[model samples]
Target: MSDALVILGAAGIVIPVFARFRITPVIGFILVGLLVGPYGLGRMVYNHEWLTWVTITDPERLAPFAEFGIVLLLFTIGLELSFNRLWTMRKLVFGLGALELLVISTLLGASLSMLGQYWTGALGLGLALALSSTALVLPIAGTHTPVGRAALSMLLFEDIAIVPIIFILGALAPYADAEGLDGLFDTLWLGAVVVIGMMVIGRFALPRLFAQAAQTKSPELFLAASLLVVIGASLATGVVGLSPIVGALVAGLLIAETEYHSEVEGIMEPFKGLALGIFLITVGMGIDLTMIWANLGTITAAVVGVLLLKAVVTGVLLRLMGARRSTATETGILMASPSETTLIVLAAATDALLIQPGTAQFWQIVTAIGLTITPLLAMLGRNLGRRVEPVPEIEEPESGEPPVIIVGCGRVGRLVAQMLTRHGKPYIAVDSDADMIETCKREGYRAVFGNAARMDALDKLGVDRAPAVILTMDEPVLAQRITRKLRAAYPHLPIIARARDSLHAAELYRAGASTAVPETLESSLQLSEAVLVDLGVPMGPVIASIHEKRDEYRERIREGGALEHKPKLRTSTAESAAVQAG
Candidate 1:
């Protein structure tokens, strides 16, 4: 209970405090763990008994929760991916991901062997260090951009390879028998069966299960059902001698296929975040400051050696695989660190007697340091990538027409695109929704998949070259943010945004949107126009009066927002008027 209190208190303090400084909360959690864990303040408790109340006396008790945090992380990753999307990246997953793991492990192992370790011990170390931190890397890179996609492909392959890597470590044990290999073969078949069974049964069962939960209109019950599925799936895989995360991932994939995935994702997000914090905290607790200080020279050399080897190997492979230089460089750096899973592999190596306990402890400390600095590595990679290629090398449109860029592909965005098409104006749409992008493509619209919330995606779309940009997503905050970024980057580029109401319109205008079209105002104007036309007003005069009212409301909104200048009208609107006049 004291331990739980300590963790909760740390989260309460760490998250907001770090966020205020615009820093990642990950560093804060790790720092809190370092401060409060048994090796830190807990060390003073023997002399100062009162310290026991505040510091974590039992780090072991938090292990299960921390592991569950990883499980939830995998679960969410599964939710973000569908079977089709996974299949689409099969070449990157199996080819690049496989080669990356094997090459890095082999090179590192050979180096360790030359340094006087036995081949078995070196191999164990090599494999352990080859893995990258999916838990840390994915959230930072996201699964959207070229860098994120590349990272996700490699990480997904690594996750899938964990069981096999462990099996190999056990097989390499000096006293290992045929029984261990037999068990592995049994696990392989059993895992396969379990996965297929879950897919078949989950497809039939999950929708009905969630439907029953949704009918209750109870958030608590919904959460209970979500947890049950994740736990049950995780246990199934664990029982079959596979990783519990496999089960969690399968559970998430199943839920994702159902209509309730979004709701499930939304409800489960807070739990996933808290659990992940516990995992990060546990990582911090593992760092033995005294041990690190004593072996600082050897540990530093090992960390730097592993980081460089992994980064170089991964980057070259990505380049050969046809990734852009910037993407390859960024992804290589981002994935250079050893993973949270590396610690697990280290534990396995120690248990199998492949590596000494002392050696495992040394490397575990190194892994912790690697995890702690992942965010810094990411920032470094991003800046370096920008320096390497100031502008992303995006492919130009085939038509040779300068396309108007649409930042969303939703209903309003689609309507805007239709009008552009009707006027023979070239345009392209970008959206974060994969399904929406596919739909747009099938309907003969030029669409790209990307998260417009990030400027990288916009830059890749050649936003600077585009004649105009439109923001049509319903998210007010996101729209405003993108508008601010676009305005700052391209001061003269016209930005038209959809607003929920007059207030939202004002906010978007203040955020640098050239024009903010409020749905409420448009609906009101349409209603007034209909009433006048039905009462026998001439159609031409009614249409002119509607446009006049819209302009009037737009002026009022801009004035209310305290804007000093009335921005020029959109170029597209002027062009349309010119064509009509001609």
Candidate 2:
């Protein structure tokens, strides 16, 4: 109970404090672990009894929970991906990812052998260091951008290869045993059978199970079912001598194929986060500061050497595979560090007698340090990528018309693009939806697929050079966020945003939107105009009155948003004037 209090306290302090300063909570949690782990405050608890209340007296007890955190992390990652997306990335996963692991492992292993270690031990070390942290890297890069996609491909392959790697390590054990190879083959066959069975059964069973849970109309039951599925899948794989995370990931993929995925994801989000935090904390607890201090020079050299080699190798492979130089550089650097799985492989090597316990401990410390610096490495990679590729190439329309950027390719955005076309203005639409992009392309519309919420995507779309940006997505919060981000980044860029209502319009105005067109306001004005026209009012007078009313309402909205009215000439104003004159 005291330990639980300590963990909760750490979370309460770490999340808000780090978030307030715009820092990642990963670092904060790790720092908290270092502070309260047995080697830190717990070290003094024996002499000072009061310290026992705050410190984690037995870090080993937290291991199960930490492992579960990793399971949940993989599960959530699976939820974000579909089978088609995975299949599309097969080349990257198998070709680039496989080559990267093999090359790094071979190079690191040969280097270790040259330094006088046994061939088996060196091989174990090489394979262990070749792995990169899926937990740390994925959340930071996300599976959206070029860097993120490249990283995910490699990480996915790594996850798949982990079982084989462990079995190979066992085969390398000094013990004279043909059964080791036999066991490896047996496990592989069993794992394959189990995985296929789960896929076939889960495809048919999951939707019905979730439906029953949904029918209960109980969130607690839904959550319970989600947990049950994750746990059951994890246990099934673990029982079959495969990585439990493999099962968790498969379960997530299965759930993702169903309609309840979003709800399942939402309900499991908090648990996943807390579990990942626990995993990170365990990583920190493993760090023995005194040991690191004693072996500082050697550990630093090893970490640097490993990072440099992995980064260069991974970057070259990506470049060879036809990735952008910037993407290659960023992904390589982002994936340079050894993974959380490095600890697992190291422990496995030690258990198999392929490496000594002391050696395993040393490498574990290095892995912890590497994980701690992952976020910093990510920031560096991003900055370097920006420097390398200062200006992104923009895809322009064939007509060479001035580019008007439409952030969504939805109904409103399509109408806006059509109007722009009629006015002889060239426009490009960007949407996150692949289907929408495909439809737009089929209709001969210049549309690109990307999440505009990300600044990098906007930059790639030439947002800086565009005449104006139109936010047509129905998400009010997202629209406002994009408006604020764009306004801050490009102070002079005109931002026109769609709002749900007058109140939302006012909010958008405050968020720096140049114009916030509220659907409710426009629909009301159209209705009023129609009623007046049907009641026998002159067309010219009614049109003029409607224009006058729209302007009045816009000014009022601007006032409500606490902004001074700034009159600006608009194309609509000129059209209204022409109508009034006629």
Candidate 3:
């Protein structure tokens, strides 16, 4: 009950307050954990009833939830990545990522050995610290930017390597002898069989399962199905002595092959984020304030030393792989922290008798602290990235001729751009969809990423000096708002708006649009014209009749202004003239 209350409190209070301050919720959750966990206030009030409600007596109790968070994070990562994109990133994912792990682990292992640690212990720690947090890095930096791509490619390889690393650690166990080697080989064989079995089974099963869930139109059912697949796969792998995360990754990849990945990702986002926060809090709980106070200098030195070494190593490797200096620097800094996986490895090492409990506990604290400040590192890296990276050039046309400013880049917007292009008009299309922008760019269209509603984004598109502003986004309210704002700011600029219906067209006109093209009206006209032409009517008459009917509809729509409670049009001589002008 206390744990649930604390989690709820963090979600309801701490997260919102952080968001209000424009600060990251990542830091807020960590600080909340530090304040409540056993090492902090929980220690002072271990037996209290009311006061204990706010404290976490056992962080380990919440470990499964934290682990679930990582599983969801990986699942979403897979959703964002397609097989085609993954195939293209194979070199980076396999070649560069593999090299980075091998080189860094080897270097760190050698350094530990030189410092008089056992070779086994050194190797264990090296492999552990060599991995960076996919769970942290993915959310902080995302999977879109150059840094994100680099981080993801590397993280994917690390997730895959976890089982092998554990096997090697087992082989290094104190008295395993030949049995350990046999077990390692057996584990590998079993893991391969499980992975293949899953691939075959999931390929046949998942789509049907999700399709049925989707057919039910119950979000609860869909979400249940998603959780079932993730837990089932993770459990299957864990039972075979492989890291459960491997199964999670495989489940994600399998789901990614189906069209339902986006829906699954959307439904699971809140769970993923909350679970991730829980994970971060658990990390904070691991930090013993008393231990740090007693050995402040040592703990601080270890934290700084690990961060600096990892950053330098990662940055240099990225640079060698042809990343821009800024991108490499930023990514390296962002990835400096030891992963949550490092804690897992450290614990396993203790179990395998590869490292002492004291040593494991010390590094676990360090890893926790490292995880705590990862978001901060990401922020610092962004600021440094700007200083190192060159400013992006503007995509505006030459001679300062204000291009046609398109507010949306959907089907209607794309058609508008195509028409403008046919007329040799220089225009720029702005859209909120990255996929739409990507698709447009691939097909040799001029599109830039921005929300039509944002003033800053519009300013970049040169909305003030544009020849005309076209609002082609299907959102009626958004179109009206943009139309009114533009009309108030640029009175002389022509605003062409698309409407859902004639009533919406009238609303747009009153909102100061020069012309409002209602999709409902146009589609009807097109259909009528097509029917007439197919029924043996001459093309000219069919077109003329369609145009006349369109003019009549527009006039009626124009007079049915938004100045009244309902759309009202007065029939007058001037209105009839306007309708007949075509």
Candidate 4:
């Protein structure tokens, strides 16, 4: 068979599944690269020989495309970053990041340096350990809350820090080389100039470029513009002596400022998904199961020790920075995985010959093994959440009767809570949005910021003690989720949910909410008819008219069957019967 066809066949087979396996393709690609190269099924395309060879023989030819994948990945990262968000996240990103970087690096570096590894090696180890896997964590984060934002920002800070670490590693090259300092300085200076220069350029020029592109209102052109910005920034970063990932990140940040940020992200998502698929698969394929088994004891010990250290350190930092205990713990768990980017740095160092190839390979293999252990650690965090008692307690004011606990503090939730409050009924509000929680608190109301889905948050809000739950979030799906969680945890707890319409309310009721108020339709209609009757309209006719209307809607929605364990209403109103059927 011809060499060209062989490589083309391999590329076709591999690239198609790249998106399917997600980040695992990076591992697949590496393994496939190894297999196709001299190591596995040695189909040596060129014997260190031909110029025009397709795959292995054409390293220079393949380099740009491989580099493009990295560029795309960074660009996605940059696009997600927002300066306003970062400003709000100063504590988590800067304060927690610094504490994590300094403490983890110092402790690990000190331990390794004491054990006779090169000080530089120890420093690198520390840095790598301090950095959590963005690929691993971000997907888990997806689009949650303050936690997701915090995780992303911390990852950003770590990615940015890599530029300087590259220079440091570069500096550690043989001192005997007279030009070593000059080389390090040049790299550092080049990186600074490029990053700062790009920020200036991105702030000024890129927005206009994106605006011009967006003016066409073509998804294709918008996609093209996003691609151009990402690739251009990435190439620029590469030119200025940094990884293409940095350029991609810078590109993302710049584009995030554009009017078309969401549109751009939507357009670029497929590319990001493709790149990430390859990245994850590559990670999975590089499992190094044998090495992982060999160092099982050390890896296990290191994982535990590092996790403990991180949890304690992160928790302390969070508490010190005024974060709630639950927030701090969630942060620790999310940040536990040692980042894949660390391996990238290790690879770069090896490529530059600043560190032995073995050093990079060892950490890479260790990291791969470490990734395997993350799920277990996350589980442990879940099971062992809030093990230590909170120092400054945030308990609700004790009441005689069980309080109506609202799971969200949005407009609807606040209104419901205020209604209850005005009636001299006790209630507590919980929301994941920090600003919403703050606003609720300032209004002289009881509210806590937390994830309603999480047990810790529910527990904090005295869910165990509460007799009822109010799901007042605008999103009916979210309301249903909160209802289900509350029902499962407290089966007897009556759940009243606000739904957009009767259909949504019915769905919520089926999802275990005792009563779902479709404000726009059923509830409003019932209340309006009652108010009209009170204003001396014919009461008997109005009551009979609405009663019939309510029954039909009830019958249509009640097919899901009885979800009630216990009766929620004492009065046999038509709404009560419908809720019971639900």
Candidate 5:
């Protein structure tokens, strides 16, 4: 299929850049798509009409793939939403998220209406203004700062709000010029109906479905069930006059409390990645460089306006919510990019006939422009982050000794600490997790309670004297943030981070980590080999051969650097295992 070929071509370009640049592959995909799209260099070879024709490129047919990207992406987000985590920031996630959506929406709407734009367009723009790029934010979250996670939580909250926003946009369609309480209530009712119906169905069917799937004990079957839950629930929501993505999100929420949650997520991970890849390429294909150039003033105005508003709002909210000054500012700057959700709102407006083609296209051009400048913005964030005041130093009490400060007392961190302890190495453990710190204390390990990325925590852990800071947070993004902070503050303190995967490891390296260990994969491979040997395969030669190939592969990967091999993850051993098990 031409659609498949397009995606492949885009991936071919993006994969290399992702490996070398430490940039999000989604950005690369978009760039590739733009170059090959009708609005850019591709227009020289094929016109828009040809690209859209079902007999030719069939662009419309890929809409569902784009839609799937949204649904699964949201679904993946929902899986991270636990009651405990929500309660940790009930005030922020609920209050701040709500305030952000309401305040920003109102301001943008009013601004657009004052500019002589139609109320429908104003409403669409209002919703669009509230969104930040999840794709962009995720890679940053991999940086591992408390600010990054806090920013991410806020973005997640915004994502959740998009469901209602879409409904509101749909209601605006029938009476294009009207703004009334009745219309608002009508949209709310539709949203309520969809939510209620899903809650009922999900509460009843999801458990039973997952329970049945578990009996099969086949990862393929589990994956099938996961995809069904996402696509089926999303489609069902679409039938009820809501965005299918919202439906999938609700579905994920419904199953969030279930025992099968982890299993479902594991099965869906690869599909989510592939779907995301396709979506990025599709988004890239839509970028109109000529239009962006022609309307530079308007596009620049829109981008600057949105970024400034979001930055101010986020900074004020975080400060008000008791976050540190550095955290407040970083959170704001890090989340200012317009991403897929913004465009999704714009596209939905077009579908509802709420915005004219020209207006919709205008917003699209602005969005693409914003996306185009995101990498530069990220570089700014990284550069600015290094300038933050360093933590005050203390003399090294243990001179010339290899000191390790394990930031998290979680499973991984504790294990790393214990390993060092067994080797008679001096180390200290710090954790924000109260229970973890208490457990470590009871176990006779030197531990303290404080946010590891916080200056106070680093000082408490004696970071200035530490020769190596071992950050083993459960979250990779959190680890990356700490790594970056440590690099900036304690330049000589070597940071050895634990990455969730190779992609994550590379990001950590970019964040200035001296070393990274993919513990999960390392353990998983060894375990899998053991299992294979138990199942009657010759383990000795097979594993040795596999290790030899793996070494060659990693050597090549290192030669290519981080950006080059980023998109070709499919060709890696990790991807092979995915095919075998997932």
Candidate 6:
């Protein structure tokens, strides 16, 4: 079939089916690819010309689409981060990430050598396997969550380390040691030049380019400009012997520095999602189930062994870096699978004669299987993490009054606790940040260091018996997760949630929160009240006006919340009166 038709078919079918099951579309796209891939239906029906449209005949034709998908994914990641945030994470990215890679590679390489593989070949394999799938993990974990940020830092460092690893492999090539060393240095210098050049050009040029596109008031033009920036930067970095993703990431970072980032991001979302699905499909295409079945026992053992080893190593490193136990465990398991870059590194090693072709092929299959099941592993990690680091339950509050439970003890939570104290209300605060909890204690607030999402922590706060639960965390996704869980466990318990905006308030309401307070709405109301009072309006009248407006906005939020929970395309039945009469 035509490429466009196939793409439309995949997107139309995979996304909704997966969403219905509350599963990630990553798994769905991969499944669809497996169904039509060469080793599946494609290999079975080459002789039937009329049935050709049912399968993907030439996977090579779709290769560029998959690569561009990864580029777009990295670009969006860059857009999400500022240089300041990236700077703050330099230690984690370099210190923890570097150590994770080095330790895993050394241990794996040593083990492979002991197993009778040549030392050089083992080392190459070790380096390759040490890497994890950035494309798969990033979307699943997100970069804003504690686990997401940690995984991102490590993945960023891994992407940077890929070029050097490939260079070292080249140096191992027969009779090319000196040339490879010289080439490596040249490539590094060129990479430095490329990064600096892109930053300089992007800083000056991207704004002007986007501004012109904006003046046209055309989405097509804006989209064209965004793609141009992504592809151009990717090509520039590729020419310097670095991965194209690095270039795409740099482009996103530079564009983020401009005021046009939001517009650019909005325009790019559909392309990014579609492209990412294509990449996942390519991963599915690489799987040869026949080979897997032939070596089922060995492959399963290898998958199990590699997963356990990486999870232990990574989880340990995260704990040492001060990550909470659950966060570390979840992040480690999410990162256990080998990466797409592992394939590239293995191929390079084979070309350099450091590993035999058959050996490379065997590991390539491992990497593909790892990629295929990455979503399942993420789910498993999340479940296991919850069980392992269940929250500590507090038997009773010091004040002996039923307390409102606050999930986060940051600035917001502290303020809420202080307000509750002033009103003779007992409260307990929980936070993941140990230092924050300590500061709260020093300031005479009752705060505990724990992940509030854990049920034990909530139980300690007497969530079941508390008059109400207050969610004050600024992390919206985490807040929603907690709210959903709490709502499920305590159907009648009132949940007062703090939302980032009106939209968030609506979402919280859908999650069964009793009241979702939007900060923006409250701030606006406060400002309006102050203005009316300044204009010589009576205090009572000003307060009344503010209350009316607030209620109006809230009613809308309630309506929106009701809409979100309503089933789509609900059918009306005409037999209700007859049934009642019967």
Q: Give candidate 4 misplaced runs (Cα > 4 Å).
A: 1-77, 87-95, 142-153, 175-178, 305-311, 348-359, 389-415, 426-582
Clashing pairs in 2: none
Q: So what's the TM-score on candidate 6?
A: 0.76
lDDT of 2 by residue, 1-582 (tens): 878888888888999999999889999989888989988888998799988778897888998999999899999989999888888999989988899999999999999999998999999999999999999999999998788899999999999999999889988888838888888889889999999999999999999999999999999999999999999999999998999999999999999999999999999999988888888888888889999999999999999999999999999999998998888889999999999999989998999998889899989999999999999999888778767755434456577556899999988999999999898898889999875886677566788899999999999878899999999999999999999999999999999988888789889988999988788777777788778878999877787787788788767776778778732323243346666777
Task: Show pairs that collide, candidate 3.
Answer: none
Please give, for residues 241-343, the per-residue lDDT of candidate 5 as tens digits: 5567667777787778789998887778877777777666667777667777887788888889988887778778878978766667767777776767888
Per-prediction TM-score, please? 0.76, 0.77, 0.79, 0.62, 0.64, 0.76
Candidate 3 stretches with Cα past 4 Å from truth are 82-85, 215-218, 392-491, 496-507, 516-582
After superposition, candidate 1 runs with Cα above 4 Å error: 392-500, 503-516, 519-582
Candidates, ranked, lDDT: 2, 1, 6, 3, 5, 4
Q: CA lDDT of 420 in candidate 2?
A: 94
Question: Candidate 5, which segments miss by more than 4 Å at Cα?
Answer: 46-58, 87-89, 110-123, 142-145, 163-197, 200-204, 347-356, 398-582
Candidate 1's TM-score = 0.76
**RMSD for each model, in Å, please?**
8.9, 9.0, 6.7, 10.7, 13.4, 11.2
Model 1 residue 280 CA deviation (Å) reads: 0.6
Pick out the ten consecutive residues of candidate 6 with the lowest summed lDDT: 566-575
Let me know the TM-score candidate 2 reaches against the reference structure. Answer: 0.77
lDDT of 3 by residue, 192-273 (tens): 9999999899999999999999999999999999999999998999898888887887888889999999899899999998
Model 4 C-alpha lDDT per residue in residues 120-221, reported as the tens digit of each score: 777777777777876666655543455566566667678767767766665665542546457667867787898899888778897788778878878788
Best candidate, TM-score-wise? Answer: 3
Q: What is the lDDT of candidate 6?
A: 0.85
Error of 2 at 459 (Å): 22
Off by over 4 Å in 2: 392-500, 506-515, 519-582
**Highest lDDT against the true fold, candidate:** 2
